[model samples]
Target: MTTDFGLKETGYIAPSFAEILDGVEDDYRTRLGDDIALTSNAYLGIFARLMSDASYDLIQQQEQIYYSGFYSTAVNSALDRLAGNISLTRKVDAPSHAEVVITTEGEYLIQAGEKFETEDGLVFDLTEDVITSKQSDGAFQGTGNVECEETGEFTNVPANTITLFANPDEDFISVTNPRPAGGGQDYEDDETFRKRLIMENAARPGPTEPGIKSALMNLNGVKQVGFIDNDKYKTDEYGNPECSVHIYVLGGNDDEIAKTLIDKCAAGITLAGSIVKEAPDATGKLKEVKFDHAQQHNIYVKIDVSINDDWNSDAGVDDIKQAICDEINSLEMGQRVNFTRLYSVTYDVNGVDDATIAIGSTKDKLADQNISIGRSEFAHCDPGDVEVDLIGL
Candidate 1:
């Protein structure tokens, strides 16, 4: 017996306006005979061109909907409504913030709400006023914190760069940021928002572990989250029940994290440590409640990468270093930094032929040990902590 195998059609070539016009003209010519002047008449040609253009546009629009339903605004809007997610085009922008330290001289009273600027024109406003006190040595010193005026990644100004005070004279006051600003981000891209919506849909029923993790991940500026069940911590220091969640966050307000925890966590479960809260006393005066954050532990990642001769450029070396830092920063609490994965990422870089990574040793392979974090601590890796060396240059 002979059997026939059917193959599916896999290619489509959309007809252009000219192709459609030619086909219509040819059909008209066939029906009316070649003696008729199909192209010479201005009115007939105009009508054919108009019909062809309309048909081509309609086909193109239909093809867009057929190929990617989400590409259609109406379709995407309907899906977002069903998924209970905001449209990717309308996602909120996250603001960047930094702590600006203002130093003044000669007992000057730097007023609250004072503004400072970087040479490149990034603005920062004072959160509170400060009084510079002159010591017996005749030197004045004071410090105050400031926040960036705009919401953007560029607002994360460097230390000592915000020296020009917008108000008052720059001669009397000096501005500096002890740490880099963080948390500023643009609205979510289509792919990221789509993935988030899918995760949300899969976890929408109730508060399962995956749901909680998804919720936390969806929060702005939260990079990674690690959850420890009751079994992980048998008891607290005082013999109380202890369950912990570790979060590695990049930007957004710290206070917002507390609020998110309260909203997402189950009742009667402790947040492992103290958290800041505001409450009113019997006198109706607001009182501040403070809690300690999870302790941070730093891990040093040392990578030596071998680059091909053609790719032994500064940009290639920088890309390798940046990749290592991004991987380390993406780690959550209690997550281990696998040396194998790190090595793979290094080799995956465009110009990296091979790489040898050591956690903290000059040796090629330091037993391939991975860094582990505790329940009460999150792993942190400073860009400075990541050491990358270019070899075979």
Candidate 2:
């Protein structure tokens, strides 16, 4: 196909700044006479320079316009527009949810907007109103649905972390979440969206493995997804049933996840998991669905750094820890964590002269080697677990 705007077989081509300026000067010389001097500060020379700049800008805009039509090169709204043509939209940010325990002295009503908080100031609000009855221990206990005031990472905390109510109530005594608040999601960024769009292009979107995973990933708050299909006539070594597809999802709404699994699965493909739930089908018929939560494996790291005067001992330690956590947490399920990769993150911080790193599953047994993760397990590192030993030079 013949393409305008310098489109070549290889890719889009645009004239360089020097070429544009030279062309303008050449045209002026050719049209007017050779005797006319085109000095640096001359009006003609200045006018030619401005014209070249304007022309170059126009060409760049044309380049952006051409690339916007393609997925690999588009950005922001342009990428969204292209993906929409294929029936895929970007996932929006989702709030983190947790099962909270409301503890009160007597019969009390917990309103939906009422909030519970951690000592660090992370807050969670109740999702619904509930009336608690007095328990045998003399404290009234009730309710479970509470979501983080914000979304994305750090929202999923450990058990019993939430202990305070946002606004004190005479009827409300204390609050604590027995389970961590999870399913917090951030809006899908352009790069992640581009990757999903490319993968979805490879297959049709229903009853297939890729389709099932893509659908689940699109759900709010879902972090990582692992797919295992035991197609043989007998039970697999992993204990999965014959002719079944077992999914390990890290985070997401239970009901939405169950429904997606039921909808995308082919008939006779048994969904394998210990957890079971009732999900309504498209026609509003109740159907039983099953799936498993991905097992989370903690990775511990110890870093010994030799640094100069520029390193702030207090803040640099936290910076190094956060860098390591982000790098390891970005790995997919079953991906091996390379010990050498940790050193790269440490050196990325300023004032680092030397770094030695080791990693392991248990805090006691750390070694400088690759840690292999299992198929159903997601590897993670906490900033606290990262021990930074700074040696002053």
Candidate 3:
């Protein structure tokens, strides 16, 4: 073979592009002459800048390509499935399961009022006087029935003549209808106002029974309420009812009712997007949204879920367990059902050899329309101690 320089002169030297550029690195004198090299290297500077910029852009594109794997189409699918499942439904007289978040202290407001009853079984307020009439002197003469000053009972009524008496000082009153006075009707006191609030603002307490906190919370504009035991009572220097019963009332734009709730419950409260604020619904608007961006992001993914249990052991019916899981997962808020922990027990019928098995069989017989199995723990509980365990998230 000829010498490398001799072959290059003949144009027969093999060179990779990188090698060619490398060979030109030290030939600035030949390419630009001694005078040009001594002046400035602006052209080289421009080329270097361009190369660096292009390299940086390429790196950024590569990074995006790498992390795209995390944004999976399956995640989007799961989200859609989850969103669709969570919804609200209204029933004529059906019940539902719901969670009650206590935002403030609530004490039952006890009001003492009298219920006046007439001899004829007619009822009226003890505070108001009534007019009794008889065919006196062939004219409709009005006979005034004086209400008792102390007992709020009417006295001096003719025997056998209908007379009204106060039923007694009762703790509660049904104010479904307000008395009509002068031109219109209006609630005169805080007690009357509270009842109106309950009618207009209080929502159904869901599937659970009305607990102290929940019942008061259901009052209109009321954020929350409940009783405080002596041990838990906040104290001053000397332990007294230092803590005035706390009552949360929402007030704000007033247009959006939920926003009002956020305003009143400044502490011991939580407020967020509809997912956290929306009431539980079985058929109404789902509180979540789901979408897939894989085409835009170029990502792929996979997810697997499995259910397994000892069908022979008889812990809980597989069907009920499955239903519980499905219902829980379907919720939009994901905070609706309390399933973080589960407790269960088994029993044995003295006459029947396997009572635990019999209970499991009964659970299996239930219909499995919308069902899911949630995370559950097992324990050896005393027989007949198996109560439905409700654990909150």
Put the candidates in lDDT order, highest first: 2, 1, 3
Candidate 2, RMSD to the unseen true structure: 3.7
Please write out the lDDT profile of model 2 over residues 1-393, one tens digit for every residue.
111347889888878777888877888878897777667698888888788889889889888988999989999999999999888988877777887888787887777988889998898888899788878777788976888888775687777998998898777777787655667777899998898888777654678888888888777777778988898998998899888878888888776788888788787678888768788777899888788778888999999999987888678888999999999999999898998988888899988889999999999999998999999999999899899888753
Q: C-alpha displacement of 350 in model 1, angstroms?
A: 4.1
In model 3, what is the error at residue 95, expressed in angstroms? 20
RMSD (Å) of each candidate, 1 decimal: 8.4, 3.7, 28.0
User: If scored against the real structure, what TM-score would every candidate get?
Assistant: 0.58, 0.85, 0.15
lDDT by residue (tens digit), candidate 1, 256-278: 55555555555455544344555
The backbone clash count of each candidate, in order, is 1, 0, 20
Number of the predicted model whose TM-score against the real structure is largest: 2
Report lDDT (Cα) of residue 4, candidate 3. Answer: 26
Model 2 residue runs over 4 Å out of place are: 1-5, 33-36, 101-109, 131-141, 167-178, 232-237, 306-319, 347-353, 390-392
* Candidate 1 local lDDT, residue 197: 67
- The Cα local distance difference test for each model comes to 0.60, 0.83, 0.27
Candidate 1: 10-residue stretch with minimal lDDT: 1-10
Candidate that beats the other on TM-score, 1 or 2, i.e. the better one? 2
Residue 194 of model 3, lDDT score: 36
Q: Where's the lowest-lDDT run of ten residues in candidate 3? A: 290-299
